[model samples]
Target: MRPEGIRLLPWLIGAVDLVMIALATVLAIRLRITLPIFSAAGDVLENTALASVFFLGTWLVLLVYSGAYEPHVFGAGTEEFKLVVNASFFTAALVATMAYLMQYPLSRGFFVLYFPLGVIALLVGRLLSRRVIQRLRSAGHFNEKVLLVGTPGYIGEIHTVLARESWLGYDVMGCLVPRDYAGLEVTSAGVPVLGLSEDVRAVVDEVSPDVVFFTAGAVSSSTQLRRLAWDLEDHAHVQIIVAPNVTDVSSERVRIRPVAGLPLMHLGRSRSQLATNDAKRAFDVIGSLTVLALTWPLLVVMMLWIKVHDGGPVLFRQTRVGRQGVEFTCLKLRSMAIDAEDRLTELEARDHVLFKSADDPRVTRPGRFIRRFSLDELPQLWNVVRGEMSLVGPRPPLPTEVEQYEDDMLRRLNVMPGMTGLWQVSGRSDLSWEDTVRLDLYYVDNWSMVQDLLILARTVTAVLGSRGAY
Candidate 1:
């Protein structure tokens, strides 16, 4: 069941937008009036008050028209932020056009400041609001009652994802399995089977679900699915979503097209195929240089501390498989004793692929502290700058680990390895070998510049929290 306040989400978002827009307007006006940086500040406060009111209303109207306040776009994904950006640009263009045509005396400096400030303010507010919504969803509020319609196997897959990502706010009320499994109490994923696909209408009416998801094998044909949608047209409040068979693909790589009156999904080339390697390389160089410039002192201090802790080498270099199955020396701070390699064979591996231990006997006193916060990996910045690694990609695999890779698993070697990637931010040493491969492969296939930046941002939080770190 959803909270009563969940219904007011759109209004709440609009209210937040209004406050941000007003804040931006006030700040822009103040900056323009007080700061002498801009030479052309005409009618700073005379007509500005009246114009600010008009601009705020226009901005809100453009945002609403751009579908920025739509319910589906809220609390998830980048669509809301993208829409806000587009609306801000649209608002700026519209106001500028109006001012030009009417010959209105608007301050040029304020006009320049307002739109950018508004975008930043709006995005920040939306981000904070999303955090609140995620917390609420985790607490079992703002949940959308979901009824699944598919075979037992398909239903299980969908249910697993919903259960894993509770922040999506989909509460699986029950599922409708195939007719053969109608007698069963529940599917393997533990979704209670309500009825067969034929009983969808009655079952939806009985459950009064907010959403009815048609997973793969839910119906025999497109005609049957279309008919199901038509039959449920009477229930206007219910949203019918069809989950295509595709999985592990980002939305950026998929698009829907009408091919001969049939809705067809077209898959675009992966990031590697898009020839973004040069851009990625430039970004890595620039990013690594900046990070090194800022953190060199800290790196030096840690190096000395590690060296002083045990009169051993400050750096540890290991041979790891990189892009195209090449070998590279991956650099890291020596977090383990000099004789740690000798003791490896004596200890049983906790993680099958990565061979990580939560409490290893080989870790030095200072090693534990640095390892937990990922300071040990800071030396890899030089490797990144040297082009042996990327700022963001899959985790580098040792030679022994790469030797065990299956043909499909070897696809991870298509991109340069990274100091930290999806595996690091997700669960680090806590993730299963299978999950680690899954996340690494996902990152390899679906990488973007924005995705890299997001991973870097999340990496900070993950390192600070020290979750799943040994």
Candidate 2:
């Protein structure tokens, strides 16, 4: 059963979106009037207001049809925002086509301003609304009670994920296992086993849960699972979720096509192919140039500071592995003493894979400060501009580190190395080698432009908190 509050959430969001759309229209009109380039003849206020109502109604209908108001997408994921943007663009295009067909003199300026502004306003409103909803759910409001129907291992895995991601709004009530298990509770994860899977309907009636999640490899057969779903449909208001045993692959890469009453799931090509795509290369160049333009003054100051501190090279360059096992000169501000490399053997063990010491005597006082805040990374923007690295990717491995990598680990070299990446934002030096490899490989497998933007946003917080930085 969906939470009663959740049922009302879509209606509430629709109302809020309507208001935001109207506000965006008004702002667009005002902007047009103030800027002579967009000025037009006619009663601007009256015409614009009439246009706003028509566009607002049409946009709302599109949003509904596009699944922008779906409960599952409400407080999490980028799907809801993506739907809103798609709906807004489609609505704008439709409006333009209608105006042309009907021969109505609609202000070109109004729409030119409205399309981007409307989508932006709606996105902002939705973001704020999601924050409020997440806060409420975190405090034990609007959460669906879930009962797990799976093997012990599957139940444990699902429970761990749900527990870690509370914003997903699932509160695990308990689990139901095979009858052969004599225990009344799951000792491994502490969730009570409500009853055996054979008595699922009886257990459902007893527990009255809102959701029943069936993990892969749990049920005996699809027919049995289908029968259970059909039987429960008549008895309870329960939503069934089935995990398909797929991992590290996103929904966007999976295409479900039904042919001859059979559903076929087709997986797309690896995202590593995108590393060489023209669009990603363009983004790297543009993003790097923009950042360099904005931060040149700070770059100059850092360069001068490093020079004054040691009277040495302002920039430190090292040979690092790039995409496809290529080598490149990775640049950074010189944050250590001139003889820091010579002292490495005396200060620490040589057996480590990714080597760093917490209180290495080679690091000067200024070096410590710069490394903490990642000021040393600014020089890498030049590498990004030169196309040797991206603004975001797995960290470039040193030659020795790459030499030690196993076959699977070399997959990280499929994409260009980065100035900042999952490893950088997740935990610089504090993360274990295993975790670092996991994150880097995950990035390689599931790279998306949106993920890159999100990582870049999180990087600021990570640098400021300095939780795992050394």
Candidate 3:
């Protein structure tokens, strides 16, 4: 959903909350036998219009101030409850404080009642709302049909994610794979297939998607990409969102503009990042030192185990290029026999398949256990601390891979390589070579801090699921 849609949800939620709070406040005042407006019924009608107004106004102000009425509350169970708890207490306290300062007098128990009432109303109402939305979307009554446009390599992955995520409210109408895509075949299921190479208007007429997502990674030339967008606007009465191909790069680090017929994209650390450059440096220094301090024990244990298990050093180091083509030693736990590298020649032609195999004869017993959950990557935190890598960015390529990079792919090396990045969360080794290059290029051109944080969040999900981990 768009951010605006999320904003709308809170308004509805806030309305429901206001009514509930007013009803509760009315009952609470009646229990105290001090009903101001209920006097019309000889304090027996149980009507408390006065307190109802007080709570309605108070809750409205509190909800707005606390950002309680936002779309995030729809999916936010505890988070929404936290905002409710805080807003409710603030309302009660504000009322009490105002009365005390004015010497109007009010009981403290009223304030105590606010907590349970607001929290319960907020949780139950939202839980029910969620069920309604889930049911509606699952049945396709409340969902959007989307036609994705991207290179053949990227379309399959996009389809896979959308097919699995039903709550996202998106139904895959079909995919438009770039006509120019020379490598990789499309995945089957979840959606129909369309031609990516055609003009946007033609595809729009055929698919009739409510929303159009144009993937930047599919096409390399900016001029052609812009023309495609213009054609889409001319052809369809649909909402269009441009998704640049970059995977790990954050938007905060990217800027875009039209220069003549070309779309020029600028990417780098911004002023905000400049301010935190020192902070990152400090984190690198402190976090690395802390890990080193605590892991010496593990290091000792692993060193001895590796000596007994595989008769090699526990630490595996490789020289990889870092920022500005600078070379640094990348560290990792040793997971293979010492001669595993020597066996590469025999597995050379099958390297791609070998890299993805769940079980491999080359992996030692301990190696298999550690690699399954990424314990083998723990030592790379040292490379990050050493300033040779970042928390998020394009993946570091091997020296041989770098030598084979095409002109367009060179943009990836402009920024520091990261220990974990968009590729890791998006499918890692399962991603085709073309898709990997496209994602890295997109990230390099569209770097931003928010994007980095999102990548980090997605990384957690990817890691826990062990999706494409090998």
How close is every model to the real structure, measured as TM-score? 0.92, 0.86, 0.54
Each candidate: what lDDT? Answer: 0.87, 0.84, 0.65
Two-way lDDT contest, 2 vs 3, winner: 2
Writing each residue's lDDT as its tens digit, candidate 3 over 217-296 gives 65667676667777776544467766655544444556798898566777665232232366655755575577678877
* Candidate numbers, best lDDT first, in rank order: 1, 2, 3
What's the lDDT for residue 228 in model 2? 77
RMSD of each: 2.4, 3.4, 11.2
Better lDDT candidate (1, 2): 1
Show model 2 residue runs off by greater than 4 Å: 4-23, 39-42, 124-142, 234-237, 309-312, 336-373, 423-432, 457-467
Candidate 2 at 23: error in angstroms? 4.5
The runs of at least 3 residues in candidate 1 whose Cα sits more than 4 Å from the true structure, single-residue gaps closed, are: 1-3, 26-36, 40-49
Best by TM-score: 1
Clashes of 3: 10
Compared with the true structure, what per-residue lDDT tens digits does model 2 show for residues 31-119? 87788776464677677777788988999999999999988889875788889989998998999999999987788887799889998
C-alpha lDDT (0 to 100) for residue 42 of candidate 1: 62
